[model samples]
Target: MLRRLELLKELLLLIPLGKVTTYSSLASLLGTHPRAVGAMLARNEDLVVYPCHRVVMSDGRLGGYALGKEFKRRLLELEGVKFCGPERVCKESVVDLKELLS
Candidate 1:
């Protein structure tokens, strides 16, 4: 289980700057529940290396962030992610899970 969580963090590194993936997307890749992905993300201690902020909800919602949603939004914005609303990320900024598998 610990190893899987570590793998999840490692996967986060694959998300490019200005792009985002969803908890469900990572869960599908890992054969785990999306909640498990969220749980592992909550425990992430090394934000710089893990880049957990790039993960969002399937509907493009910001979801939870260890550093607070606003900070996460700021970070994503700095990376050129455009929001569709106050909390939803623009769909164009989302990366498909298939892109990560390769």
Candidate 2:
């Protein structure tokens, strides 16, 4: 499980600039639960290196960040991630992890 979490972290690092993904999508790719992905991200100590902020909720909601939701939004904004509304990211800007790994 630790190894898998490490792999998930590595995969997260591969999220290109300006691209974002959902916890559910990542869980599907990793063959784990969305909560597991969230747990792993919550425990991630290296924010910049791991880029956990790139992961959002399935509904495009900004979701949780260790720093803060506002900070996460700012970081995503700097990377060119667009929002659908005030709280959710634009679906067009989301990264498809399955296609990405393929």
Best by TM-score: 2
| TM-scores for every candidate against the unseen true structure | 0.94, 0.95
Query: Between which residue pairs do clashes occur in model 2?
Result: none
Candidate 2 positional error at 98, Å: 0.4
lDDT per residue for candidate 1 within 37-74, as digits (tens), equals 99989998898888999999999999999889999999
Off by over 4 Å in 2: none
Evaluated at residue 67, the lDDT of candidate 2 is: 94
Q: For candidate 2, lDDT tens digit of each residue in 20-95?
A: 9899888998899999999899999999789999999989998899999999999999999998888899989898
